[model samples]
Target: MTHATGYAALSAESPMAPFTFERRALRADDVRLDIRYCGVCHFDLHQARDDWHNSVCPCVPGHEIIGTVTEVGPDVTRFQIGDLAAIGCMVDSCMACPECVRGPEQYCVKRSTPTYNGKDRMDGSPTYGGYSDHIVAREQFVLKLPEGLDPERAAPLLCAGITTWSPLRHWKVGPGSRVAVAGLGGLGHMGVKLAVGLGAEVTVVTTSPAKSADALALGAH
Candidate 1:
């Protein structure tokens, strides 16, 4: 186990504060990252408050994470020291399950282990999120942060960006496709940008007339 420091919600009702805990030592396929930027999601608030009722305290809530690789296990092949890496909402899953084999492990048949508020399948250890100074995760769950994409701005790509992009990619959205996004918020805005990038004609139907200009600026009609 490795000692780590971070902020966590000691109780459902209390605000997050400094916390120290042990993270499992690197497995053959694991990479340890020194966290740099953590993006907050509304989901973080809900989990921090135990709104879904399954939160394990001391809860550290952050999934949209960007960091620099600090260490890699002997079998780690995808990343090396100093490379920018990102961790998303999932940390691990039963790779043998049908859902994982077919892709989209997020919908793993045996329940995908979320980045935080999840239990490690192997030892039942509570899995913590990225609201910390460092995190150790299997290399498969860590994404390579492309060079020149500002780490801070790119953090949300792990969640918001992927949330929108996955569906579009799955549906084979491309030139001549018609896409309509219902809101102009985080996920919606990213949907508009990606849809348009795929050469789709995008229409953003929003309740807020105020967001119309913002939508157009994001490349939606």
Candidate 2:
């Protein structure tokens, strides 16, 4: 086991405070990462506060994670030590399920293992998250940080970015496609950028007329 330190909410009413925990020893397909940046998603706040009524205490909540590959297990082949990498909301899943094989592991029939506030598939140990010094995850759930993207700015892409990008890509949004992003929030802004980037005719639908300039600046028509 590897010792790790991070901030955690000890209870629903508690503020995040320094906490220490153990990361499981490397499994053959695992890659260990030294965390660099972790995006603060609203889900983290909700989980920390037990707003969903399902949070575990000492919840260390963060899922948009960017890190450096510090070590790779014997069977790991996709990453090398010192590579920039990332982990999103999921850490593992039963890959034999039809959903997993078809490509949406989030719908894994056995239920995908979340990055935190979840039970490890192997040991049933409560999984801690990326607001930590280091983390161990299966290589299948890790992504290679693209070479030119800035890690700090790219962190949100793991969650907010992908959340919007997936559907845009699924619908084959492209030149001549009309895309309407609903707001200028985290996910909305990303949707606009992605839709515009994909050559779509993007529109930002907002209740605030003052945001018109901001929306236009973001490439929304």
Q: Evaluated with TM-score, which candidate comes out highest?
A: 2
Candidate 2 Cα outliers beyond 4 Å, as residue runs: none
Give each model's whole-structure lDDT: 0.92, 0.96
lDDT of 2 by residue, 109-179 (tens): 99999999999999999999999999999999999998999998999999999999999989999999999
How well does model 2 score by local distance difference test?
0.96
Task: Report the alpha-carbon TM-score of model 1 versus the true structure.
Answer: 0.94
Task: List where candidate 1 sits over 4 angstroms from the true fold.
Answer: none
Cα RMSD of all models vs. native, in order, equals 1.4, 0.9
Q: How well is each residue in 1-221 modelled by candidate 1, as lDDT tens digits?
A: 88988889999999899999999988899999999999988899999999989889989889999999999999988898999999999988898888898878898989998999999888899998888989988888999998899998998899999999989999999999999999988789889999999999999998999999999999996
Give residue 145's lDDT in candidate 2 (0 to 100).
92
Work out the TM-score per prediction: 0.94, 0.98
Clashes of each: 0, 0
The collision pairs in model 1 are: none
